[model samples]
Target: MTAIPPSPATAAPLGDGLRFAFGTLTVLPVRVTRWDRGAARTGMLCAPVAGLVVGLAAAALGTALLLLGTGPLLAAVGSAAVPAALTRGLHLDGLADTADGLGSGKPAADALQIMKRSDIGPFGVVTLLFVLLAQVAVLAQAYDGGWARGALAALVSATAARTALTLASRTGVPAARPEGLGAAVAGTVPVRAALLVLAAVTAAAASAGAAFGTYDLIRYALAVLAAVAAAELLLRHCTRRFGGVTGDVFGALAETAATAALVVLATG
Candidate 1:
């Protein structure tokens, strides 16, 4: 089916935007007063802000563990678990569903249908296994460098991941279906808004690198650029394979971007 434009509405208030973002993106208890198209659009725009909160919390946990002389592996595991727990693993589920759909190599309809099934498939299983493992491994390596470095990486990666949502919602992007998140926010982001988000996230990443002293300016910028590149590629691939973006697609982009950012930081 062809994608439809969102209904006309005024820009969401900052209070409503925060409500929508925190309520939808995390399992945190927040009252969402508005559930309209405007709110959804604002939430997508503000997604990176929510990520900052999650990332900071996760980093704090890992840093605390490290300060207590916990092993890098344990610190890493704790750091990784914070976001997953706070977000109710919503993004991970998206990653799994997207992997399953893409791996099916069937028609778009069939693949989407496969993704909607509650049970995990072989593709989803394998993707989750490796992705989660990679997160732990890379995070552990970062922690080995120092608690501050590990915390900075986690913070930057989380912010970068959520920034992908804004890009995915840019104008001309289509919703895979007529209902749900894809329909609610797809094509809602304007070029100006997307650019602003990109700039903000880039600055945040650079600041993190400078604060940590582990990554030089060039390396940090490259890592952010690489993560953004990966997210864009995923968006294009999903559009081709699924005929448009879905809620799962948003999740997939966020997780993929986060992992890419973290991996780059760890390696650098």
Candidate 2:
């Protein structure tokens, strides 16, 4: 869901930024304290922080389940479910809508219209099924390695997913519509700010994996890059096809980044 906006907007405080990020991005109880462009810019920049929280929660659940002897498969499912639960499955819904829009092969305006619909079609259903399965498979692989490995997978992938949002909102990315979440946050972040955020996230991911082994350290670093690269590819295509970013496009980007990160962690 979008962040709530009130009148008499002012420049967002640090607290307002955090509130906006959590309030819009998750089912967390935090109330959005501001809704100005300043707040949105900060919110998009801090999107990875929201992701980090989600990832930690997801990792905790998976690790706990494993400690309780549920096995990796079930733990993987539980871990995978956490992000969806926390975000009210909005990102997943966005992904489905995006898939429908892309698969329609209609003119840009028509495709955008299709995505605005509430119902899921064949393209959306199939895309969601495969994406979910892929996420589960990779996460299962990670858990099979060890609970810690699985936890890292959840943590890094979710962070990467949110990181994608930061990049997608970087300056110059137009909004596909005149209103909605995309428009509010579109082009809000300067390119330099987005890169700095990416660098910080990649470094943290690599450092986290270092606890395991040298190989894991490098793998985790690559996972972040791969995730962002995949998302960037999709972002370019979406911009070209839809004429700019939409809320659905943002959701699709998150899922794409998360899936890519998981794949890199599992296989490399």
Candidate 3:
């Protein structure tokens, strides 16, 4: 799949970007106003905003469950289900495909071919099992601490996951294929834009942590660092193994970063 250049007309308005972000990332019934490179770039930049909504909804679900006398474990399950259900498990599918591709250890072309298959491989199955379990477990721990802690963790983790997309789309990043989401958004994020988003996310995370306690502030910082590290590792690994970033890689990075953030928050 050879990469193609985006046309000048690909850019759209900010409202269109919001529509594209929600329409693409969630099962919400928002009408997508555009489907060009400009919209895609703006959509990726607004991804974290959508994530904030999803995370809040998820946290609310968990808090409600707890108030209704549900066990922390069950509340955690419900919280985890919110984003998965809302997103139609798109990120999970990406994580599965990426795991299968990387686990196969094949050359770039063959690995990409494997990822494109409809059937999930052994590696994909195992990866999904472990990742889901980890999410549930860590979320349960967070809930055990308190509703506010659990909700904050969910919100921050989701935002951090989306933040990875902006970094992945920054200039100099190549698309793995000529078509699809990766190609549309690749190299669209300027360094300045990426830095600004990163700073904003960090500030949001810090503020959220401050509401909990001093220890929580330290934990949140650690989680943010872990999320960033996970995203960087995924980007590097995908670039080396698949020649560049792909839609699947973006999905995998989001899930990995979210998991890392949650794990750090739950344990630290």
lDDT values for all models: 0.84, 0.90, 0.85
- Model 1 Cα lDDT, one tens digit per residue, 127-155: 98898898889889989988977887788
lDDT (Cα) of model 2 = 0.90
Candidate 3 wrongly placed segments (more than 4 Å): 1-11
Cα displacement (angstroms), candidate 2, residue 169, comes to: 0.4
Q: Write the per-residue lDDT of candidate 2 for residues 7-68, one digit (tens) a residue.
A: 22234677878887898889999988776678888888899999999999999999999889
Clashing pairs in 1: none
Residue-level lDDT for 242 in candidate 2: 97
Clashes of 1: 0
- For lDDT, the strongest prediction is 2
| Per-residue lDDT of candidate 3, residues 107-138 (tens digit) | 99999999999999999999999988999899
Per-residue error at 5 for model 1, in Å?
A: 5.8
Candidate 3 achieves a global lDDT of 0.85
